[model samples]
Every structure is written in structure tokens, then in C-alpha cells.
Target chain A: MTTSKPTVFIVDDDASVLKAVARLLRSAGFKNALFSSAQQFLDEHDSNASGCLVLDVAMPKMNGLALQQTLAAQNSELPIIFLTGNGDIPMSVRAIKQGAVDFLTKPVNDSDLISAIQNAIETNQTTRQARSKLHELQQRLATLTPREREVLSHVVSGKKNKQIALELGTVEKTIKVHRAHLMAKLQVRSLAELVKMSERLGIISSPLE
Target chain B: MNWITIVWPMMAASILTLALLHLVVWFKQRQQVAHLFFAIAALGVAVMSGMELIVMRSVSIPQVVLLMRWLHLPLLVVWIAIICYVRYYFNAGRLWLAWTACYLRIFALILSFTTGQNLFFSEITHLKQVAIFGGETISIAQGVLNPWYIVGPLSMVALVVFVVDASITLWHQGSDTARRRAIIFGCIAFFLLASVGHGVLVHTGLIHSPYLVSISFMPTLFAMSYELSYDVLHSAKLAERLQISIIKREQAELDMQTQRNALTHLSRVTLLGELSGSLAHELNQPLAAILSNAQAAQRFLAQENINLDEVRDILQDIVDEDKRAADIIQRLRLILKKADCQLQLLNVNEVVQDVLKLVRSDLKNRGVTVNSNLSNNIPVVTGDNVLIQQVLLNLMMNACDAVADAVSIEQRQIHIHTRWNGTAVQVAISDQGTGIVSDDIERVFEPFFTTKPQGMGLGLAICRTIIHSHKGQLWAENNNECGASFYFTLPAYSGETI
Candidate 1:
């Protein structure tokens, strides 16, 4: 897939690392955003932006993990890649569990850092697209009537028109009309598309399954 | 009778001999002013006694009067000398009282010489031979006492007042010798006063006896000599105690100093252990940068269009990074030096900066901001370079540790200041964390005294030891705003390089 220049947001309290990492990423043809502290990064944070955070695990005021949590809370799809001077298993485990892309220890290999940033940026783009698709599905779902919403849930759950009718205590002809209106509102054609839309809006189970 | 005559003369001679012996001691040690005065008083008593003995043997009234006229001279000398002895030995006595006694005795002496007849006896009735002690023929006087004879008693009263006042003062003020002085001087003075009264009454025929003032003074003289001997024994004992204590004090100080050296070494080792992680990170930074720059340079060189300026900048950074790495190691090596402390002239600010370089990584890791206000005119101090660096390292590391758990990064600040303070140069390190409690400020410098759970508690103690060894002082105080400040002062370099 073709991609534009991906920015690597490098946040470290150490001036040397901030400058060094920024330069390294720059030389590798990646756009760089540098911040001395996590707070400064948070101040200029773009929640909608798709990039990778090459953040120092240990920083003054707010650390990498804390920033990761804040971004996660705000539902930002920006992937974080942690860089630490000393890597403790528990800290890395926590950062990864909080949706961080990767955890690397300094003096990180240039190749490894570049790959992690690549992976993170790729992941961020995928996540951003998925989030936007889910948002579209939610907006479409919001337009459906109560009867149509029930009919859509039954349809995504592998129910036939007659079974949905029986479950909703409606006639099969009435269930068919409600299904058509919901599908049109969701802008989907095949049952597969309708099922996928329902999954994205979390009408049934997770989309991964 | 024979025993009495021999005892009286023998006692008089013994007092004179004791005084002369003490005079020899006083001559040997001129600081013993009291001994010399005692000798003079004793000699005067001996002279008066000898003349009194002659007056007792006189055959005619005129001959008795002739001896009596000379008697006041020795009496006056004895009185003056005794006052001086009391003043010096007891370290007491009012100056005015002493002067009054001396001047009155002098006036009495002059009156005795200038008067037409004897100062004590205006008319001598006859020389009545009496059978005195030891079957000695002593000529008793039958005379009408001169009204001016009251001068003798009055002078005696003044001498009595002076001695009594001195003894009382010594009793109140003297620490070790008060009791002894009060008893010895008080008893001797009272005895002398009674002797003077009895001698006067006997000479005027109120009692039928020869003049016995000399004999009376003999017992008191023996008592005074005994007191003097006791004083010698007491002082010798005191001198021995003083010498022993001085030696013991010196030995204790030496042991403390030795312990300090060992503890300082131990603390340095401990500090190295603590900083080892940050040191690795510090070294890794430069190493990583240098590697990256070299790679970058090689990549540029391989390119068709070579970027010479970029490659030059990259190579320059690598060189600088190499030096930075080497500088860290050099600082470490100097601090870890295992040798006896050597004194050298060092800029206080330079020492502090060197230490800060060593701990820069650690401070960054802990998110502590260090603010150093090194004065431009900071004077050089004479100290062991490595030891001073270690002191600063320990102090700065301690300050960093102190503020590690502060609520905010802004609160986690360590401030270092160095300035010239006239006679000395001072360095102060302050932290904005939990300040040392008032009671623990001094105790912080005691070995094995620690506030940290993981601390071996020898950092401050070792710092203090190192500073003290350099003839400097180290102390800690709580800051008004927050946390604690540790200060050390080193003597300024005085052109005398060690």
C-alpha cells in the first residue's frame, strides 16, 4: 500500500536522546516531532492524527505509559512505541497491554526503531480506518427505527426472515420490510456486508472473531 | 624547761628553713609567686623572733627599749608579706584591704622609729628576770604602755581583716582549693591575732609573763608550712591527671579520624554502586550517538554525490561524543581513586561541576532539575581534589535522591551554589523534598544514621569526615521554603600549596 511520510513523535526528557532519536528518524526519511517532556507532547497532541509515538518510557510529570493510557482513554488510534533506557518486564508488559505498539530499550538499534515505527504507523493507519468505518456504521445504525434495529440484530445473529418475525412477534412480510429499511439505512447489500456492519457497530460480538 | 627553750628555738629555725627551701623552689619556677611571698613572710617572722629573743635577754630598760624599737621593722615586713601571700595563694582578697594593712604596718613601723621612746612602751619600770621555759632567763618588762601602742593592735586588726576577707572570698569562689584554703588560712590568721593581743597584754603587765609572740607564731607557722606541702602534693596529682586526659583525648581523636577515612572509602564505594546504572546509560548515550554518526558518515561517503559538510559535522559529533564518554569515565576513575587523600588547590565551582557531570544521567533519570549558581569570583580552596569531588558527588546524589518522590517535577530541584566567604570558600547544595527534621539535622552526619530505607547511612557522615580532614566544616540546615541544605566551607588557597 502507498503511504505518505509518517511522523514519529519522539518524547524524552533527555536532550541528547530527543535530538539523537529525532535525527535518526529524520535520516531514515521519517518526519519527526520532538518534545522534551510528556506534558509538552500532550499539549500539542492531535487525537485525530495517524502516526506513531516514539516515547521515552521514563519522563518527568507524565511518563510514556501514562500518556499511552490518556490517549487510550480519549480513544486516540495513534500507536505508541515505548523507548526506555532500562526495560523492566512488568513496565513493558503494562505498556503493551495498554495498546502500545512495541517496547524497546535504548541505545535502541536504528533498524529496530525504524521497523517498530513502521509497524506502529501501519497499525495506526489500519486502526484509524477501522475506527472511521465503525463511526459510519454507528451513525447509520442511529437512523434505524426500533423495529428495524431489532430486525437487524436478528438478521446479523443468523436468523431467517420468518424466525426474526416469530422472535419479534411480527409477520414474515413485515420482518422483510423492516430488514430492507435497516439495510438501506446502513447502506449495505449482501447479508455478509450487513453482518460485517452489525459487527463493527458491536450489535453482536467482536469483529475479530 | 630545757625542752621548751629548745622547742621554741628549733620551731623558729625550722620555719625559717622551710621558707628558704620554698624560696629555692620559687626561684626554680618563677610562676610560683605565692611561694616567694610565703618565703618573705617566713623570713620576717624569723627575724622578729630572733630580736624578741635578744630583748628577752636585755639587762636594762634602755637596752630592752632599743631591741623593741627594731622589733616593729620585722613586724611590719611580716604583716605586708603575709597579706601578699594570702592574696596570691588564695587568688582572693580585696585590693583595698591588702593596701590598707600594708600602709598601716608601714605607718606603725615609722612611728616606732620616730618616737622618742619605744612605740609600745613609753616608760620601762624595770627589767624583771623571769624563769621561762627550759630554765631560760627571760627579762619580763614592767612598763607603762604608750597610747600609740594601739597602732600595733590596729595594724594587727587590719592584717586579720585582710586575711579573713581573702579566705572568705576563696571559700566562695575557689573550686578545688576553697575548703583547704579556708581552713588553713583562717586558722593561722586567728592564731596570729590572738598571739598579738596576748603579747601586748603580757608586755604591759596585765599578765605576768615574758613576751611570747614569737613562740605563739611558731605553731601557726608550722601549720602554714603543712598547708603549703599539701598544696604541692595536690597540684602534682592534678598535673598527672591533666596529662593523662590530654593523651586520652588525642588518642580518641586519632581513632575517630581513622574510622572516618574507612567510612569515607566505604561510602564512595556505595555511591558508585548506586550510580552504576545511570553511569552505564550515560556511557551508552555517547556510544550510541557515535555509532549512529559513524554509520551516517559512511552512508554519506558511499553516496554518488558526497556531502562533505554533512559528513564533517557527523564526524565532529562522533569525536565530541567520544570525548563525552571518556569524560564520564575519567570522572568515575577520579572519584573511585583508592589512595590517601592529597591536598591541592582547587576551584570550588570546578569541583562541583565535575561532580554534576558524573551524576547528570542519574538526575535526568530521576527527573530532577539541577540549578547551579557558581559565582564568578569563587575562590580556590585547598583540599584533596578527588575527596572534594566525592563530597560533592555524594551530596548532589543525596539531594537527587531526596527529591525523587516529590509531587511534581518542579519540586524535584537541586540547587548548588559556590561563593567566596572572605576567609573561606563555601559550597551549598539544597533540595526541594522532605526536609530533614530539626532533631535529625546534626544526626544526619553521624555514621549509620539514615533516613532512607535502603541507605547504608554513611554518605553525609563520610562527607563530613572528608571536609573536616581538609580543615573545613560541613553542616546541614532545613530550608525555609522546603527540604534541606547542606553546606561546607573550605579554607581559601593562601599561596601555600601543599
Candidate 2:
């Protein structure tokens, strides 16, 4: 898929503050989306959208932390930066514990909000990149036939071809051919790369045990 | 050396002593007119006793008759004095009755001097020696009885009727002191009757004895003196009790003042805790906008291709937001500042609006929608503005809490109304929460009485105190439909209109 430019999503109940923050973000050369409420944001949320959410923690319904919980349940990769008018310690601590990028109090300094947004956007990018890479790897793993997949699991578990052939009740030549074909399909240039790929796919467990 | 000579003089001296003591009392406290009348009566009685002694000792009929005629003057003085004393001391009597009695006695006195040799005799035929007080000899007059002698007894009967009538009026007044006074007056009437009856029996020749009317008059004087002295003693005790009660009332006022100050302080603290969150949000909104708008303006200015129009808009927004934040701070300062109560003429509707503005966000957060019906015709009221606002804030806050857990949006409504009720401006706050527990309706305004798990319970109590100090009233009642309504009234300003 073609990657789009990351957009900062800002959700705040306060209209003037929301407009002002959006203006600041625009001035700072950031693409931004605005939602006046958590429900509005939730309604318009896109899983595939790559960005960080700057959320006010004291909204009337579905406060920032509660939205964070909802997003977490949905396995969303959107990083959150909490903004509260008066942030208490326990609340800030809880927000940070629940995977919020930062908890900022309002009348937030421009540099602080900008930096927190930048940090959250970077976290979102890193998580999305990792997810996509895992998706690509899973696609590559799906290309192997059943016999090649069995051979790859045994080979990555540090099994020699003769021991693998004995366990599979197959000839050593057949086991070698299956391993070579699976390695080519997985695009590994060396045995170390093959073993690393097996570890990434969680196929290194000894099937005989 | 008859014992009558010594005893009559002794009785005269003792009655004179009593008169002198009361005269001194009347002189010191000139307001004691009753004491003055008692002194006059005692002195008259004393003079009568002296005259009686001379009559009893006279050896000739002419001497005895002359003394008897002069004795009527003292008798008339005593009768008038007793009438005046009873009238003044008891503070009750028929005025016409008293005047008639006095006039009748005066008529008898005139009759004694003009109608005959004396009121008791048309003529004294001879002087007779009589034995009295165990056979000591004293002279008595024997004569043809004056038909007008009946006037003397008639006057005494009138005096008795006057005293009895005054006593009955006093008895019907139904106070402990008045009843006691009535009893004393009854005694005076009985003594007067006995003296009159004795005088009549002796003068009518029904018994042979020296004229002892002066001695008989002594008991009536003694009864008058006892009543006067009892009054003096009772008044002194009353003055003492008045002093003690005055001191006690002053102490109680001081204690109330101290409690009021403490409650004011406590209420401020409680208000701060309750409003801090809303205040932070209130202040932060404008501050956040101001900061962001300013920074955005800076960014726009620093750019090579700066948009001056946008920058101007940003600066304008910044100024507006700054003013908004300042306004919030000013309102908060007004609420939290500790100051002596300074009363000023205030518009009730304005006070309601100010408090509603302060708690707008808080009520919104609790999902309570306030409906205000403020009457424009409300007259201005004199009150401490901040204190009145505090009262409104407290009531509104309670209204918010009342509806916080309501099952429906309709039940989360609060209605505040203000209007002039002729003499005073009244404000009522009604909520759609479940009505207060019928028993807790009044108790809710008592200090430290709360239904909320975390409530300090001083809100309603403090509100009431503030209202009372403003010469207003605050109370709560369950609404007919669904909730409790709190009502308070502030008297319209009666001073010069501002």
C-alpha cells in the first residue's frame, strides 16, 4: 500500500482552544484533524490512518483516558497524548501507564505540546511500521506448501536433515529439497537468516517434543 | 396613770416612725408615688391617735367634744390617703368609685364640723369615765346621737367597697404579683370594715367603751405599709433579674457571632474545594487559547511570507481570550476573598446570573440543565453581594448534585426563578431529583446534617445563616411532582434608590 503523510488528530471539548491548537499545528507545518468530542473522533476513526491523537482529558463524555481504553481494546496503533486543564499525579500516571505518549496540562507551552505530538506521531509510525513488517512476513510465510512448512519448523529447531528425515519418516534428500525450497520462498540468503526468520515467525519450537 | 396614756402615745410614736421611714423612701426614689401616699396615710393615722388620746384623757365634756371634732380632720386625711394609695399601687380601680368615696368622706368631715358639735353627737351632755385595758380609767363622751352620724359609717362603707372593687379588678388580671397585691388589698378592706363596724357599735350606744377608732385604724395602716414594702422588695428582685438576663443575652449574641465567623471560614474552604476543578477548566480554556494563538501569531510573524491579516486576527483572538481569563480570575477572587460583610444595593437577577455563570461548567459536567425565569420587575435588594452569590452558588450546586444520578435527562433539570413578592425579592431553586426524604427536608439545613456520602453538610446551613444575616429567610420543601425546592427571600432595599 502507498503510505500517506501522517496527520495529527486533535480532540477537545473547548472550541476556542481546539481552534487555536489546530492553528498552532498548521503553523508548525503539520497536517491535523479536529474532533469536538471523543464520540466524534471515535465515529471518524480509521484503523489504517497513520497519526497521533492529541486528546483533552476532561471531555463531558468519553474522556481522553476512556477513549484510550477503547482504542486499546480495538488494537488501534494510534498513539495518544493526554491534555487536561488540571492534571493530577495519579491521573497522569494512569494515562502514561495505559500507553499514552504524554500527559500535558493546558495552557500547554507550544514547544511542549509540539514535542509531545511529535513524539506520539513517531511512536505511531514505529508501531505501524512494525505491524506492516509483521504482516509482510506473515504473507511470505503463507506462500510455503505444508511439507515445506513442516521442514522449515524442524530445520529452525536446530534439527539436522538426517534427524529431521528420521522424525518425518522421509529420505534425507527429500528433507534437504523441502528446506531449500522453503528458504527460497522466505527469501533468506543464509542459514542464520533462515533461523532468524523462523524465530520471527515463532516456528523454532521442536515439533518432535 | 392609766395605761391608755402610755399605750396611745406609744402607738402614735410607732405610726410616726413608720411614716418617717416611707417619707425617706419616697424622697430617694421620687417615682414611688405609692410610698408617698403610704407616708401621708401613716402620718394622718398617727395624728388621729394623738387626738384620740387627748379625747380619752379630757376631764370635761366640752374638752372631749372639741377634741372629737378636730379628730375628723385626721380621719378624712387617712381615708383619702388610703384611697389614693390603693389606686396608685394596684394600678387598677374604677376612677369614679374612688372619687365618690373621697367626696363622701369629705362630706362627712364637713358634716362633723358644721352639722353638729361632732359627727357622733348633736350635743355632749356629760363626760363619763370608762374602764378599758384591764380597769385603767379613761374619759368617754355621752350624748344624743347625731342623725348624720350615719354619714361616717356610710363613708367607711364606700371606702371598703372601693378597696374591694380594686382588689377584684387586680385579681382578674391573673399574674402572680397582681394576685398577691389583690390579697393585700382584701386585707385592707377587711380592716376598714372592722374599724367602721366598731365605731358604729360604740357610737350607737350598743356597747360602753372609750372611743378606740384610732387603735382600730392602726391595723389598716399596717396592711398598707406591708403592701408597699412588698412592692419595693419585689421591684428590687425584678431589677436584679433584668440585669442577669441582659448579661446572658449579650453572651449568647457573642457566641452566635463567633459561630457565624467560623462557619463563614469553613464555607469558603468548602467552596474552594468544590469549585477548584471547574475554575481550573474555566481559567485554562482561555489561557490555552491565548497561548496557542500567540504562538501561532509568532510563527506567522517569523515566516518570510508573513500573512499580516492572519496575524492580526490571532492577536485579536489573543486579546479576547486574555480578557476572558481575567474575567474568570476576577469572579473567583470575588468568591474566595475574605471580607467583612458590606451591604450594597443589588439586583437579584444579576446575582442569580453571576452565580449561574460561575457554576455553568460544573453543572454541565454533571449533566444538569438549569432553567432560569428571572423577573425584570424585581426591585433592588440590600445585601452583601458576595454572600448572596455564595448562597445562590450553594443552592445551585446542591441542585446539580440532586439530579446527578437521575434516571433520565428530564429528571436532570434544575429550575431557578426570581421575582418580587411585594415586600421582598424571592428566589427559588427547584430540582427534578427524587424529592428529599420527607423527614430530612428541614434537617438538611442543619449544620453537619448531610445525605451525601462525602458531603460536609454545612452548605445549606451556611446558606441559611447568610440569608438570615441579610434579614432574609431560607427554607426547603419537597415539590409536588418529583424533587425538592429551596426558597429564599431578601427584603427590598428601603434606603434611597441608587
Candidate 3:
């Protein structure tokens, strides 16, 4: 997908700064998305896209910090890197506290900004990956029948079919049938894979051990 | 009466006319009490002289006695009025002595009516005709003097003492007017004593003539009038002198204020001149940007696969950044322009940005990094835009100079901060460099004080003056770690609108 190449969304009120920064990123082989204001970025941004935001701190209407808060409120995984012409210690501290990837002053060094953008994009991808994994596991868990889910949970806890059937007040053959269905639903081939999948889903912190 | 005897009455008439003229002057300026008293004394002398003429023409003892008795009336007034004249004019006298002389004259008047013919003489032995100049003859009374008649002479003697005492006191007090009064009244007293001696001798028949007391008083009266007129002229001269001196003092203060303003303006102009080179480089920044963008667009257009989108953006930035550089030059020109001080409401942040724009190229060239921490929502400040811009430029350029000497490029930093503190907006520029020497911190604002080579040293001094004229304050202090921080404040304009 085009998403494999990370996009840097830049929002700055100064057209010259926006142009210069876009040119720098384009030369550095980075995909650039330019917006003139924070509101513009919010209005047009694709929430499902995995990328990082490069925002100017002193924009009119809505500033970088305010945008950081809005994105945070929405549980957006988009990492934000702040750029400002007049950066102070307190402002950088506040931005960092709000989970900003980096706070840089204007006329920023190209390598510094590029590395920070790279770091932010990597973090966004890592967070999205983990979220999608959990989502996939939840989807699989949702498809299982109630009896099959109960049978699967006991089996993944290192219980044998005999032990699971005894706990369910059922025969071993009936427990075996429910386990087969749940394994197929979860798409796991072996007991070890089933345990590993359950662990990935955060159904348990660890297998029976 | 002989024509010579008529001389005394004519003299009395002239003296009366002179005194009346002075009385008219006194009426116009009633504040001079001495004039009023001098006129009264002169009138008394004139009337007494007339009475003496009447007594001299009497052909019998009863007639002479009657005329002499009435003559005591003016005699009483003459002594009392002259004493009052001395007191008011010189403002110096023994009150009791003057009162005693007056009371004795009053007693003499009482005896003249009560004892009748025994008033100034116990009895008149005979009346004799004395022939004089012009073949005119006048009657002279030969009388046995009453012992009690000594009262009149004694009072005259006391009157002389009062005049002498007042004159001496005036002399000892020692001012120009006092000395003049002393001399004037002193001569009057001398003439008065001689006049009285002549009158006494004539009354006792020791000399064959009429009493000439009134004529004797004329010189003293003239001197008193002259002194009073001199006092009026002296005060008028003094008033004129004071008026001239006050005008001169005000002019001198105005000149000093104007000079101070000129010095402040000159210092600002000189600072702009010194920063001209850096300011040129500042303009070059945007020009270089525009050139690079245009060249890059030309290269893009020539390519077989032309990137029109990138080329379009490049051309647009060139135009915009060129305007940015033009804006910087415009701000620099504004400060350097010669103009009168015009105060207005200004946003301090905008002023700060203008200063930074002019100095940006200089900072980059010198490897100095600047960080600004301007607070949002600062209120408008009241100041002259050009003058305030000059102050900001001076501080920023000074900051760049301060950071140039640091050990490393990374250590060379200038921080510009601003905040709104309720009543005023404050701007602080701090640098990380060699800090100011402890003793030189306060002296930095003094004219002609400098640590840098080739520095005129009026920069900080002018900055302080401009801020002070705006009813603000500017100061500098060394930072704990390194370098120094300079701060200034401008009062917030509180009007509803600019």
C-alpha cells in the first residue's frame, strides 16, 4: 500500500516555511502533506492512515499544543513533532509532556528534523501494528461459540480434554469436538500456536507456566 | 513788616506748597506712611511761621501775649508730627522718648491756655520796634521767662534726642536705605537744634528778631521728601531685575532639556550607522533565497519530465520570501529615517519581530543562535515607533556582540523574552557569553563607557534615556551562569482604542 511509505503531514501558517520544509522533505525522499493551519490539518486528515505530524507551534486559530490535545483526545496514534520559531524551555516541556516526539526551533537543521520525523513515523507504525494485532485477535474471539470459547480457554490454560470435560461436566469426545471448532475459528494448527495466539490477544499474560 | 521779615512767610508758603505736592503723591501711593507724616509736619511749620508773623506785628503786650498763646498750638503739632515722620521713615526710634516729647508738647499747650500770659513767659516787660531791611519795622516782645516755660524747650530737646537716636539706629543696622535714612535724618536733627536755639534767644530778647523755627525746618523737610522718592525708584528697579532673572533661568532649563533630546537622537542614529553592514547582509538573505528558488525552477522546467507542481511552489516561495526580505529592509529604513518623535500605541511583539528580522542575518553569519519566548496576549505599549525600534535593535545587536566571544558556537546564544506584568510589558534580552565585569554593570549605562574595541559607548546610555522618556526603566545584570541580561519595560496603553 502507499501507506508503506510514511507521510509527513506539515501544518504551518507561514507559506514560506511550509514551502521550504516541503521542499526539504521532498528532497530527502519523504512524502509530504502540507496544510496551512491546524484546523485545515484536522479537517482533511485521514485518521486510518499511519503517519507523523510536523506542526508549527505558533499557528493562528489552533496552535500545535491544542492540536496535540485534540489528537490525543481522539486516541489518534499519529505522532506529532513540534516546530516553532520562538521555542522556549517551558513550551517544549509542555509539548513533550503531551507526548510530542520532538520539539525543534525554526530554521531547523535538515538532518535533525528528518531523523525526528523518521522516529515519529516508526512509533506510529509500531503502535498501529500492536493495535491491529489486538483487533484481529478480538475479531477471532468474537466468531467463536460460547461453549467453544469456554473449551478453548481451558485448553489454552494447559488443561487436557479430560480435565476440561470434567470441569464442563461433559465427555472427553464432546470437549474434543468444541476444541476442534475453536482452533479452526482461531486458525491455529497446534497447541503451542493456540497458546501463543491467546497470549498475543492478551487473553492471558502467559501460558499455563 | 520788612521785606526780609516777609521772606520767612514766603519761605513758609513755598515749603507748604512743596509739602502739599508731596501729599498729593502720597495720596496716589497711600502705602508710603512717611509721606503723610512729612506733609503734616510741613503744614505745622507753615502755620507756626504765620502765627509768629502775627505776633511780631502786634503793637501791645496783650496783643503779643494773645498771638503767642495761639502760636503754641502749631508748636505742639510741629514737634509731634516731626517725631512721627522720623519714626515712620527710618523705622527706627525709642518709642518712650518720642512719646515723652509729644506729651511734653501737650503739657506746654495746656499751660499756654491755663496760665494765659504766663504761658512761655511770666510777663512781657516791654514791646520794642526793631527796624530792619527795606525800612520795615516789626514788634519784638521783651519777656521775663517763666521757669515752667522750660517744658516747651525741654520737649524740643527730647525731640532732638528722638531724631538722633533713630538716625544712629538706622546707621548701625547697615543697608543702603538705612544708611541713606541715617544721613538724611541726622542733618535734619542738626538744623532743628540750631533753629530752636535761635527761636529761644529771640523770645528772651537776647537777639532782636522773630522766631525762625519754621524756616529752619525747610532743609530737613526737603531731604526727607527726596529720600522717600528715592525709595520708590529703588523698589521699581528691583522688581524689573527680578523679572529679567526669572526669564533667563527658565530659558536655561529649556536649553538643557533640548540638548538632552538631541543627544539621545544622535546616539540612535550612530547605532544604526554602525549596524548598516549587518543589515545589508540581512537583506541579502531573502535575495539569496529568491535566487536559489528561481534557479531551481528553471532547472525543473528544462527537464524532459518537468515537475510543474514543484516548480510552481518554488516560484511562489521566491515571491513570498522576497517580500519577507523587503519587509525587513522596510523596518530598518523606518528606524534609520530622521523623524520627530511621534508616540503611538504599538504591539510590542510586532516591534520585537521587526528587530529580529534586521538582525537575523547578522546572527547567522556570526554563528549565534537566538531563541525568543514571547508571551501571548501582551497588551499594546505606548511609545514612539522609531525610537522604540531603535532601542530594540541596539539591544539585539549588543546581544550578538556579547555572544561572539563565547568559547563555542553552541554556547553563543541570545534569548529574547517578553511578558505582560499587569501594568507594563517587559522585554528581556539575555546572552550566553563572557559576562559583564561586576564593577562595569552599573557604569554600562553611562555615556562613553565601553568594553568593546571601536565602540562609541553611547548605546546603552541612549537606550536608557529613550526608555526613561517613555516613563519606563531599562537595566542590565549579569546572569549567574554566564553573560548578562538586559531588560526594559514600557507602560501599557490603557485607552479603549489606538
- Residue ranges of candidate 2 with Cα displaced over 4 Å: A162-166, A169-173, A205-209, B1-269, B337-353, B360-388, B396-439, B450-457, B465-498
- TM-score of the second chain, each candidate in turn, equals 0.52, 0.52, 0.60
Q: What's model 1's lDDT at B376? A: 88
Docking class of 2: acceptable
Q: Which candidate is the best by DockQ?
A: 2
Sort the predicted structures by lDDT, highest score first: 2, 3, 1
| The 10-residue segment with the lowest total lDDT in model 2 chain B | B360-369
lDDT of residue B307 for candidate 1:
75
DockQ for each candidate? 0.17, 0.39, 0.03
Candidate with better DockQ, 1 vs 3: 1
lDDT of 1 by residue, B1-498 (tens): 444456557767887898998899899989988778778878888887777766776787788888888888888777777777777776678899888888888888888878747888777888887776556667787777777888888888887888888778878875766878787778878888888889787876777665667776676666667777888898899999999999999999988877767767777878888989888987877776676666556655766788788877777777888898898888788777676778877888888777887787777777788999999887777888888888898888888888998877788899999888887888899999889989988999988899889998878877887788888999999999889999999988778748
Which 10-residue window in model 1 chain A sums to the lowest lDDT? A1-10
Compared with the true structure, what per-residue lDDT tens digits does model 3 show for residues B233-326?
A: 8888999999999899999988887787677677777777776766665564455446445655665566678788898878778888878887
- After superposition of all CA atoms, the RMSD between model 1 and the true structure is 13.1
True contacts kept of 2: 0.70
